[model samples]
Target: MDSSSLLKEYPLNPVVWDEMCVQNEVRAPYHKVYEFLKQISTEDLTRKEEMARRLFMNQGITFTVYSSGEGIEKIFPFDVIPRIITAAEWDFIERGIKQRLKALNLFLKDIYHNQFILKDGVVPIEMIYSCPHFLREMHQLNVPHDIYVHIAGIDIIRDADGEFYVLEDNLRTPSGVSYMLENREITKRIFPDLLPQNNVRTVMQYPQLLYKNNPNGLLGVAGLMSAYRKGNVAIVNAPGNGVADDKAVYIHVPAMIKYYLNEEPILKNVPTYQLNNPDEQAYVFENMARMVIKKTNESGGYGMLIGSAATEKEMEDFKVAITANPREFIAQPIISLSSAPCYLNGKLQPRRIDLRPFALCGPDGIEIVPGGLTRVALREGSLVVNSSQGGGSKDTWILSK
Candidate 1:
């Protein structure tokens, strides 16, 4: 039997299926992807996967999971489809991300030092006060570079019109950048033709850029604000950042902005209510069915309660827990997350997903990576995009044209 007959016999193996036949004649993007995959053999693809696994292991690129006991490191799941981004599209995304990061950094500084934005009524004081993430301990404290956000992964999603909008900001210890670099390497081996044909820009240099020229470099925030007499150089990613990234600490961001920057914030935060605030807590206690509650500092897909998905007993338990310690939780209205085409089983299906584009701050200016990690909720119709919760990732290729 030839390759076609072999494929008919073994339809479950993706490697065999892809190599056995010519894909349907599609348009530009899909045609391009299929053509590239056809050039590599099934055995070659397996070899590439092994190489990727070795590369990750040699580089010590692993994340710690707590439940498996402390110091249990695991490799992140790698996907073969390398998302491509064009130069022209990258230009727009880069500018937007930089502008947003700059404004947010300035906002954090101002909220901690002066109440200008709050006083001016651009953002309500109650919103800041009611945030579960607001860190009172950071008030009037000097961050070495006057920069609270050292690394940022701003989440964005494209709507039906194909326009992108900011969904949320991952300021503290944003993960998945490692996966971005590794994905590029894996794709290059599996589909070498995809790069030259698509004119994809190289993103391998990003990690090095992040390590060097940290915002806390010698020349500090003096240029942005003149209130501080001395500049201190400290890497914000010092030990204990895990504790700081908690959702409860988020409430203090606005206050951190006022107390440290002595200016007003330009960007707006999502409307939130702390379960601890007396009035807000009471309101949440009364209307548990209308809100999406989240634990202050949990990462991945854990510790979340979608009002529509909770049982009566669970809702009652949550109310009791909030009454005991409201500071540990926050609530927001559900925003419909975006979706994209994904290859599931054997067909293309719509999967709910989100994007996380990275931003860097330096004396010259801010740099935002044009391409982001497009994460999909692997389970059918699921909205959670975290890799820890049976989710998969795709490459985001920004169109050059």
Candidate 2:
């Protein structure tokens, strides 16, 4: 039999864009590797897939999966077929990312110093003071270059329309970069020639880039912020940046972009409802089952209510929490996050995914690594892709074409 005839059948979800193919045919950026895949026998393909897993195992490339109230180190699930973005798409994404960072860093600096965005009424003072991480101590404290956010891991996602959106920004110390770099190294081994054939961009310089831009050594956000305040040290994603990452503050991002950069936002956020707004809160509470509510300051996927899955007790508890301090929360319709093909149970299946591209700011300026970590919800149909919440990662390829 010919190599094409030996290919294993993989089900495709037509509702979402498949990065590998436009329809049944392989997408242009993936042509080189899809053709290569057609030539591999199923047995040999399985062996190669298994080898990829073994390589991860041997290299100790693992992430802690904390589920069911316990932590377990598991080999981060990696798919051999990478998620590819065209050069045009990447250029647009890069511009949007840089625009966002510039505005956000300026916003942070403004809130801590002049409070201009607040005084001008671009963002409410309550929203600034309402943020749990908003440090009063940061007032009038100056940092090198007036740049507050040295590193940002902005969460990005594509919907059915095939447009990119910034889901959220991780400014207070972004994670998963190690997984991103490792994913590229593994992809190199899986399809050594496919990369050069596709003219894929490299992500190996992220660590060095971060090192060159951020503090040489630091512990926690507050400590680093304190050091920078005293002119004794420098920090990345400088502390008190939580003011921007706060889900409540997230709603004001577009306004912030317009206010600070005076530029329209190239990327947008999912429609969010601030519980602090009486009308929005009423709608959110009444339609609790249709929305996802999150605490403004919480991270690591905690303090969240998946309205569709919440039990009566959980709903009541969340309602009480919202009632006690409404400003601490925000709600959004549960987005049917786009799905991508993932290898699972010895077969290719669809899984919801999200991307987090890291942006670095220095005297040189904002630089985003062309590649990022493609986090996949390993469990069938699950939307939460955080490693702490049973998510795995994949390699992302930004094609030169």
C-alpha lDDT of all candidate models, in order: 0.60, 0.82
Q: List the residue pairs that clash in candidate 2.
A: 150-237
Q: Write down the TM-score of every candidate.
A: 0.69, 0.92
- 149 in model 1: Cα distance from truth in Å? 2.3
Model 1 reaches what TM-score against the true structure? 0.69
Write the residue-wise lDDT of candidate 2 on 268-322 in tens digits: 9888998878888889889999888898877768889999989988988998999
User: Residue by residue across 1-401, what tens digits does model 1's lDDT show?
Assistant: 13343224332322111211223223354456655444555566556656766866787766666654576667765444444444654675676666656656766666676857778776667656655556565566566655667678877654443455554567767888877776676667655667778766666768767766473343334543333223335554322233334565445445444554554433334457877678988777677777778877666767778777789999888888777767678887654455544544433344666778877776556666656687877776576777766677766665555
Deviation of model 1 at 179, angstroms? 1.9
Global local distance difference test of model 2: 0.82
Worst lDDT run of 10 residues, candidate 1, spans 13-22
RMSD of each: 7.7, 2.6
